[model samples]
Target: MLSELQKETAKAIVNIFETGSARGDYARVTLLTGDSGHLTYGRAQTTLGSGNLHLLIKAYCATPGAAYARTLKPYLPQLADIDLRLDTDWSFRNVLKEAGGDPVMRDVQDDFFDRVYWTPALASAKRTGLGEALSAAVVYDSVVHGSWIAMRDRTTAKAGAASSAGERRWIGVYLDTRRDWLASHSNALLRKTVYRMDAFKALAASGNWSLDLPMMVRGVRIDPDALCLRPPVNASAIEVATRNLRLTDPKMSGNDVRALEEALSKEGYAINRDGIFDEGLETALKSFQRDFGLVDDGIAGPATRLMLGI
Candidate 1:
């Protein structure tokens, strides 16, 4: 049976990829293309080239005799015919957003992640004799971001050493290999997103193979068994308390930074939407603070969060 920790590890991976943190299914529009070389959105990190658009349409069509699905049925051919890369167009995005509102998109995401990613990952973990929470988490992420065949091939190639060294050591080996693969990938965008590998390395370094202790991913500390409610659909911003947030703090990451950066950008402050609350982000935060009559302390506490509405 899958343990609760293992399940949360899956959710946590999704959190890191989709929202930067473990609280919500925040909508993100980072760029036409970024480090991942894919247009990304929602909790599942659905990318344009990854057949997710096709999956969404199929998912919508799967609903039996629903008007919404039927309304979109006519456009299925158009959706299918359009090049995934051309989805960068504003018109295409608007149509996609309309067709796949939050509820349907969540459904599609759950379906794809469960069927296409997590199920295979879980099965592969069993094959590899992996039972640790962190190991399962890593496998799931590999399946989601890369593919089962590639990860399996790599694992098999490294199996001799991993078998001798045990599961923990195998995880380290696998992560190192994955990092190298990403760094040397043909796609420059994929190559630049090696931070995902770095994050996993950090998790392994902490010796929490079972993921029983708190650890960081994408600068956010993930406490074992920590539970967070998914935010409502189309939520403009997330509410935060004074606790668990600070400039350069590991806890202050994920959607919080994305939200802050987006808000600042709207008000004419330039910042990267990488989701890390670095010094540049701190400076931008202070600029926003000074303008909004809040303390320019640069810590994203309750007051600052409220002022930014994120």
Candidate 2:
């Protein structure tokens, strides 16, 4: 199971990555390059290779260790179900002894952790007052949510679907996020263990790996840079959305009457394909917004369209 510390680390670190970039990580080299990519690869080939080392490296190089656990006091219980045996006291010495002679592991250790230690927990503590809101997020009892995310990322990446970005169909998104690495070891046990050790170092450095869905640390085969981001989240101005929607049907926004008629059609109360939004449309819009968990304003804003999944 993921130790309590792992959950804290994962939440804090992922919070930074999510809110921080909308889609990216932290740190200098890799992060500086971009969230949608890696460093040496970008500089050299402008491409993320399909290699396990690169994937693990990418995760570590993006955030700080200290920051990983700094923001997760609320949801630490979710790490309970993960049966991670990596950091158990018994394996502590074994890992170190194993890495004792590996120069590459030793060399990257400090670089990996330095990034982890300095990154702030990124609770959006000061930005949106979400720091306090984050404090209230559900606290589940599971193991390795952090590690699970990491492993899941690997699975998703390996599927090469992330490269499609927002262009991916819903199935693409679902499949990429779900992957299994255990049955697909594809390599000798020693090599697998070595690669896993590297992943652990990266995980430990990020300080957030979840044991819950632990397969992520095994490795990734993603061909990143293959995808682009989804269209800017439906955050475009509501007026813009309204204008566009009105344009689609035209007769909808001529006046309050036409607009209301169109609005009613949009709200599914009446299907006046004739595009005039009338007062009835306003009433319908209000009801539609309420049902969709949006602000109950009669204005046809971006929120409405998104909820409708248009």
Best by TM-score: 1
Q: Which tens-of-lDDT digit does each residue in 1-310 have in candidate 1?
A: 6786668766675566556666435345434333332445556555544444444555557765433575556655544433545446665455555644556655665565565456556766766767777788887776556544455567668765445668877787787877787678665556655776677777778776666646656656567444443321111111111132346334357775787788788879989778778888888888877886554657554335434434
The local distance difference test score of each candidate is 0.58, 0.29
Q: Candidate 2 lDDT, tens digit per residue, 191-298?
A: 222232233344434532232332232222112221223211100000110232322233345553455455456657754545455455556667776774544646
Residue 54 CA error for candidate 2 (Å)? 40
lDDT (C-alpha) at residue 270 in model 2: 57
Query: Model 2 — TM-score against the truth?
Result: 0.25
